[model samples]
Target chain A: MAAKQNQENLPVVLVYRRPQFNLPHRNRLSRHFILLDPADSQEPTSSFLSTYAQSVRALLCVGYSTITSETLSLLPSLELIVACSAGVDHIDLQECHRRGIAITNASVAFAEDVADLAVGLLIDVLRKISGADRFVRGGLWPVMGDYPLGSKLGGKRVGIVGFGSIGSEVAKRLVAFGCSIAYNSRRRKPSVPFPYHANVRGLAADSDILILCCALTEETHHMINEGVMTSLGKEGVIINVGRGSLIDEKELVQFLVQGKIGGAGLDVFENEPDVPKELFSLDNVVLSPHRAVFTPESLEALIDLTSANLKAFFSNKPLKSLVEIEL
Target chain B: MAAKQNQENLPVVLVYRRPQFNLPHRNRLSRHFILLDPADSQEPTSSFLSTYAQSVRALLCVGYSTITSETLSLLPSLELIVACSAGVDHIDLQECHRRGIAITNASVAFAEDVADLAVGLLIDVLRKISGADRFVRGGLWPVMGDYPLGSKLGGKRVGIVGFGSIGSEVAKRLVAFGCSIAYNSRRRKPSVPFPYHANVRGLAADSDILILCCALTEETHHMINEGVMTSLGKEGVIINVGRGSLIDEKELVQFLVQGKIGGAGLDVFENEPDVPKELFSLDNVVLSPHRAVFTPESLEALIDLTSANLKAFFSNKPLKSLVEIEL
Candidate 1:
């Protein structure tokens, strides 16, 4: 009954300040509901949120932006936290659950493009596509003789770290290329035909390539550490299209430097927009600017999904792409 | 009868002088026949062959090295020419046919890797994998904002320019990626499941991507010219894994500059080792030195196939990968 009264008074959406690279979400969002962005005010974010504490029913979180318990406590009337990215690690999930506030994310939104990127990075690292391009672009092809031979994609034992929507899409594409598929997920999917290893180490030990496509949580943070990379071995490669924190970046860099791991195709980094300078010079490592989610077609899809999720939440309809907070 | 006598005595295999980058074929070839390499001799190539012309019945023509009528005339005793590469454009086929010299090539050996490269390039160009990799490595992500979005590959209309072994392999791999396959072959392949376009322009008109995998012949020379590129429209991508002569390079460059065509993934350039300076700066294009056939595993496969073909010819058995000269 109190919730009904809150809806009667025009529902308010509190939005975080836009990241440097974010696409404009306000103009489209303003067409539906009243948006209360903190950046619009000259006052500090905490101060602005505190002023509208009783009215803000939902918060729209941007990529990699934090929502700590202290911040959550400031918005006592908050009900839903809408994340604009697939990885919700930046959000305090425990606090959301404890407060009984529901959380939603861009899961179905970025799945296809991220999967496409995961496959692209894997193929690039395996075939030396980017390295060869640099060779030709540098005028080295004409003067420096032939580029070295690259490994084949067919017959490779590819182990996916997360067997979710994106990982499955990646497996589907690689399967067409004749790669043997295996995986390590939080829980074994009985219907999935690919071999499942219970742990990342076991998956790495059995895999020729380890692809990270899982979400980041307490159990999965730094899951691909030295021991996992060691199990992956000298001939094995790592492809990360998932969140950067999923792998221990320091260990991966050290292993890449020592040639303990064969190669890597990384889209995300531990401190994104700030990759290690050491990786810049490596021929085998293919670096992407955290853009697995930035394809134009993907961006269009995201805008539609974002709008739908927002509208559904405001009208109190069933939410779109509502992520299970625990899983 | 004479062939039997020549086989009884160790058969003479004449090898052409290799360019700087070719692998050493002597140690491996020595097991089956007496190798008569021109580079081993201090005398002129003509003079060296003249001394053992009668004994040198088999000629192993190294990659794209011309076997002109003049060279063939000098080796009057030569009856078989084993080409070490797939395309026999450099070899004067009319003269070889007039002389009744049988030929075998590395088509079967390099088909899979070449097909693998074609798919890799297609994915690279469409997804901007290499371009995005360059953006990250340049440290542009921290300040330069989001990289541009790329197109998806799953639903693109891919037209193969040939339907031979390599072409068919490319089709199989692409079909797995959910691409709609079509073809433009000299004759309709009744057995092929893909739709057939009678000419290059028609194929381009219907295709979102064009994959050049045909042999470069008199009929196919400069096949993908201005007309074809124009027909392909501004959104089409071209992947050339075949010889560079298949496309008119100037027209391609002009089209790319004007955005008449979307992008290209070129492994073979018209004047290799001399790619257009303009191409070096284009983010959309993915350039590779003519290396689709040179993977270490493919090289090992080629060595085996070469050995088998040589042994088969000497033993008077049917040849493997023997080209249908007229077809």
Candidate 2:
């Protein structure tokens, strides 16, 4: 077929394992790029990458697939790392910086959905949506008469932990809900109107709610701890849509159990796929597995942006979503 | 005995039966007016109302107590019915109109919280916040790997069914989250920016989401029927923050079961304290126990508003929250 011939002529792209979803647009990616999978080759993964992907100029990293320095070395001809995920912590940024390999993340494509989730979580925690859902599902409504009242989101002093693309989007949404917004970031965002706190503890001290949307880095690891939780006080809520390590997970669970803080709506956990079982029964907390970026609209947008970035790379045009590696 | 003596000097006010929860504000209401309750007297309920509430000029209606013609007949001197609730469905609007009695609902005090819940429910259903929270809590994440992707709220064509105070508030909040808004009101709102559809069926046909915030009048009852749900199609979500009867509950359950519609986030059911057991197991539908107006903030605001309205009534000035019972 002419299409098969065209596929053979297209540039080889080493696509990491497919995302575990029914991605309708992912199938269309082949029309633009000849996607090759190491898992599909008869040979083992490392050898397959060395043989077939050695001359591959671009690699499309899907989900949280690790791209190590050793793996980068294998793809000596690789010019670009197109991440199909918002967070690039799994990819070795330092190695890419050393090699001068270009990195394009899915931030622009996924920012709205992630921000949507962050606001959703904040509302859920404050309104007890998940808890109320559980109570209704348990057939307790008829007997219980009325579900417990939840706190209002309006006029709450909200502190955004990262005022990045995702955090900023969250502030935009919550502002319409009448929440007063503030933030704590690596640097004060001059373009933003919110008061910037340099420290998470200070942010918590001033905020009735804290929404975490920063990147996971060594310096920012375990940024939300017992002291910060205590500072947030008995009525403060924390909504984390960023990586799990952004908070002290054990301490958060302990604080939630001990009632040091109001509640939480957690999309990610420190030991993911292994959430603390203690949270299972808590009416105040809403626990969701790390799924902030998991939306059909976001995923489709990711496919489009990633394909454009690859097309731009092959054509030597300005790349889309290129992240300046702060090495 | 000074407090008891002060109560004798205060103006008489007939307080309706208490809500299920402890009313911390009810104790303080005595500081403004001499509170009268049928339950407080040793006489029977009807006898107490006839004896103690006969001369009461202002009555504080709490919870869903029915102000029947008979009950109103007992308080012939009653001039104002200050409801501590937004919906006056339980109150005899026709009877009050015929008797030329004034009524004031908690629309102003509870609009923000109800709107907050509507937006929260929309986000929860579209993003599967409640379902994902359930998946994580059930310890199924490790086994399930990832929850199914939910639709994005951004850019979705949201058709608001009723465009009153709560609907306007919901639209204001959702616009910031990137939802394209439309509405179906009894009459076109000249002040609104969104497109206006004359009928709900047409609105549903054009919308990815439908948010019901209209009052439950005789004509407005069961507004969301099978035709509307079918027009919304397989990807459309319905969010009800208004009274339960606004939707045909039986048809909604059938549609969800057949996958004819996308999902629903129900804050109020057709029957109070009773939801369809069929909806209990559906993953797409998010069930809430009629608590959209039950936030602590709204409750406090209601207390303040009710107190103010009662104060205004006794002083013979214009009342706050005066419902102009459209006769």
Q: Each prediction's DockQ?
A: 0.61, 0.82
User: Which pairs of residues collide in model 2?
Assistant: none
Residue A124, model 1: lDDT of 80
Q: Best by DockQ, which number?
A: 2
Q: Output the TM-score of candidate 2.
A: 0.94
Across B91-188, the per-residue lDDT of candidate 2 in tens digits comes to 88899999888999887888899999998888888888899988988899999787877888888999998887788899999899888999998889
Cα deviation at B125, candidate 2, in Å, is 1.4
lDDT per residue (tens digit) for residues B113-146 in model 1: 8888898898889889899889988988887877
CA displacement after TM-score superposition, residue A153 of candidate 1 (Å): 1.8
For residues A167-286, what per-residue lDDT tens digits would candidate 2 score against the true structure?
Answer: 889999999989999999888979999999999999999999999988887877899998999899998899998889999999998999999889998988888899999999899998
lDDT value for model 1: 0.85
* Cα lDDT, all candidates: 0.85, 0.86
Off by over 4 Å in 1: A1-62, A74-79, A303-320, B1-12, B17-30, B55-57
True contacts kept of 1: 0.72
True contacts kept of each: 0.72, 0.95
